[model samples]
Target: MDSSNWAEHLKQDFSKIRLRMLEKLEEFSILRLNPKHFYSIKVEQESSLSPLAELASINLESARMLHIKPYVVSQKSLHEIEKAIKKAKPNVTINSKDNELICSIPEPTAEIREEKIKSSKQVVEEARIALRTKRQDLLKKFKNWYPSENELHSNKNSLEKEISRYLSEIESEWTNKEKEFRQLK
Candidate 1:
């Protein structure tokens, strides 16, 4: 692959790490609610339809409430949105009022924050492992590109620096999210 392709692959790998964290979409944090988790929800009795992100606009109404206003504003769409949310997160309580669905997230207690912080650390560590694995795979590919042993070693070192840079980006994001969870609302 060319240098441009190499850069794109590295960028995509970083994004994959972020998307993996969104696998825990059932959690109350709106930041973790990536489109990947809600992209498949069929709405309005349609076999093929837009995803939840397109069907509605989500607003952080409050620390404990997320307001979702559908663009079409139909009863069937409302029910479908409600069903999608319920299917995605059964524990969250959703109320419909004035053509909007309000998802009631539980108050973030200290225990919950602590639990989330722990889990966030675990997820970051998993990302680190995944990154290392990706680096290994990339190294094998690089070996073919760099025939000389010394040249391959130099490229491997540069690759390690790039991997560390991506890991630091993930680390910074996790720390910020942890701080957000620890905030007093």
Candidate 2:
């Protein structure tokens, strides 16, 4: 497969494995250090079956990384597993070791999105300020000489257009940043 396709596949596989590992690990409060490389399962001494190794088998080469040794499975599963292991223990090796099982979880932050939103708000605020300033300058220039209604409306419209140019520039900058942020993820 191509690089991007392979990366997507790996991402999907890791996501599923991480979910399952997290759920199972929560039972024992056994924090998985590198779940992507190691999985920890608790088994009771009484149980003949190997609960840890069973899950480990699904992800090959993961055994070498299990370092947290002598983890106890729940008392109930231990009893059942002991009976099952009588028929299965020989098939499962008894080794306790934790290794690098780094879990790769992708977490996206809202900071970038928030920044874009703030920029948009800033653009509007700036436009309002510019328009207000222009109106003040116009009033000063007319200096008590009342502008006719048509002349006043036309002047205000023209000033608004000038204000909009700055607003458009701010909007374009925000858009470019947003696009760049999306690509980073």
Candidate 3:
């Protein structure tokens, strides 16, 4: 590997780290009533169980309400959706009205919000660890290429800067998510 390639290489790695961080952040359910969460359930079809998201359109009717309307509205489909949602989220209130299932998500308790905040902090800590690991990998690789103490120290400083920047980014993301979680009703 050429010495000049470090910048580009680390840039790509940081991008991947950032992407993974964002993906993990999306799993913070307390932050919002994400429609994607409902898609994870499987509803019974004619012969087999299929992804509910594939058969129906999940719309966020409000912050705490979800309207799941199947493409082909029928008693069978409606029952299947209600069953699936109940199975996955027992606390959710399912009401069949018109041609859609109106799901009312229960409000999270104070303890639940605290638990989610703790988990979010853990995720941020994990991302920081991952960044440190990447920094170490770069330092090991630079060992074979760097010729003098000056170049070695220069690269270490660069890695530290990247780490600091990413840590800040992770913290900021978590802080914003925490605010959202606190606002949940």
Measured over all alpha carbons after superposition, the RMSD of each candidate to the real structure, in angstroms, is 4.5, 21.3, 1.9
Which residue pairs show collisions in model 3?
none
Give candidate 3 regions above 4 Å deviation: none
lDDT of each: 0.73, 0.39, 0.82
Cα lDDT tens digits for candidate 2, 72-101 = 434454344333333432323333224212
TM-score of 1: 0.66
Candidate ranking (TM-score, best to worst): 3, 1, 2
lDDT tens string, model 3, 14-35? 7787788777877766446678
Off by over 4 Å in 2: 1-146
Rank the candidate models, highest lDDT first.
3, 1, 2
Q: Which residue pairs come into collision in candidate 1?
A: none
Q: In lDDT terms, how accurate is model 3?
A: 0.82
Error of 1 at 151 (Å): 1.2
- Best-matching candidate per lDDT: 3
Give per-residue CA lDDT, model 1, range 12-53, as digits (tens). Answer: 887987788645423535323333444455554576656788
For candidate 3, the TM-score is 0.90
* Position 61, candidate 2: lDDT: 32
